[model samples]
Target: MNDLEELRDALHTPPGFTPRALDLDAVMTAGGRLRRRRRLATGAGAALAVAALLVGGGQMVGGGAVPDRPGDAPAAARPEVSTPGRPADMLGDPVPTGLPAGTGEYVLYGRTIDDDALPDTTFGMMLAVRGPAGDLTDRVIANEVVGPDTAPGFHAVQGANGPGEPTFGYYVGPATRITAKYSGRTVTAKQARWSADARVIFFWFAPTDGQLKMLTAYDADGKKLPAGHNVVGVG
Candidate 1:
């Protein structure tokens, strides 16, 4: 058909079906159930775990040098396997291809709300640490969920890891920049897309000692946004 005629025909075409309104509460509940089932299958007790650990190295606690720059820590030792370890399946049913972010010592597994088939409105990310040889228990360090808000903000968690591990968390909304001060140094966190939507960003930084201070998030226009409360461990 000619371009003008095709355009006219398209405009007259009937939608194949009626659009149905989504039941947000019901959908959210279903998503929660699915998540709980997955966690049970993995034998993971809580989505978040808090403990002290060295920022770099295979061990979770004590005696590892912190990288001077964020994302520069040495790779954590991977468990030897004749084949890849079974997928944790934490992110989604068919987990995102590139996941488990971080150097080997600690990895972050996550699924953006949209990534879930049922889309858990309260789901965010899980921070995990490697365990002893052949120990498959999920060593979740933090589980931070932002709910279904579009406000540019982040939820941060801190643990008593000796020498301090990286302050980790997830940001939801339209923040393009995230930074914080820890132990008198200004640290900038590395950001990555955690969702198909541009609004969700997962971030972390080089390990720093002491309490995290003035953690801040900024939007594209350079306006500082609200920094959500720093919950002890996970929120």
Candidate 2:
């Protein structure tokens, strides 16, 4: 017999037998619910993958945790520049003549000779009398007797003022004697001593209108050495 004929024969129930109909609407509703659940699960998996990818990309690009706000970034460090007096005004006015032509006026701190005896601090202003190329001296001449309150004496020996050479001069002091020639004339003064091997001559003399009295180099027997330049400091 054919399959359909057999199923019909089997369906032919015995006496007093009955069969119930299937709920087609309920089955269709259960199938729809299963499909909706599958779609929701798939969407949730895709969302989680996308979130993981975004976090990984952020880590790769930023090297670490990302900054949450604009102000979260670290500030850049800066270098410190040391200047005397006002921080705003580091350089001073340019010296007119004595300094090298290109050099300008700036504050100079005095070096401590003996740390045990004196405080390791700036004694006074070392006026940087810079000049044109090859015209300025580099060594600093300081006075032990006078402190920074008194202006240091600066003298440039006329003929001997050369590069890498010792220029003899004097720092104004007590009981120190000075006698020399200037502008083809001899000028004598007491309380001064020879300050050899020094560029800046530290002296305790109050310059008038930024001018020091001109003098020449003298010897022990009152003999004049070479001609020299007398440069003083102002405010």
Kindly state the number of residue pairs that clash in model 1.
5
User: Per-residue alpha-carbon lDDT of model 1 for 1-235, expressed as tens digits?
Assistant: 7799898999889878787889765555444433332231122122221111111112321222222232422233222321134333345321121223233355555533223322224344544443333122333333333343334467534432333345666677677888877667777777777644466676776665565667788889999877765443511
lDDT of each: 0.46, 0.29
Model 2 accuracy (lDDT, Cα):
0.29
User: Each candidate: RMSD to true structure?
Assistant: 19.2, 41.1
Candidate 1: lDDT of 100?
33
Best by lDDT: 1
Q: Which ten residues in a row have the lowest lDDT in candidate 2?
A: 33-42
Candidate 2 lDDT over residue span 1-235, tens digit each: 6799888877774647465577765544433322221121123332232233233423422232322222421231111222333322122322222222134321122322221111221222222333333232222222222233223333321112123211223342222334444445544432222232133333222121222345544445656444323432110
In model 1, which range of ten residues has the least summed lDDT?
48-57
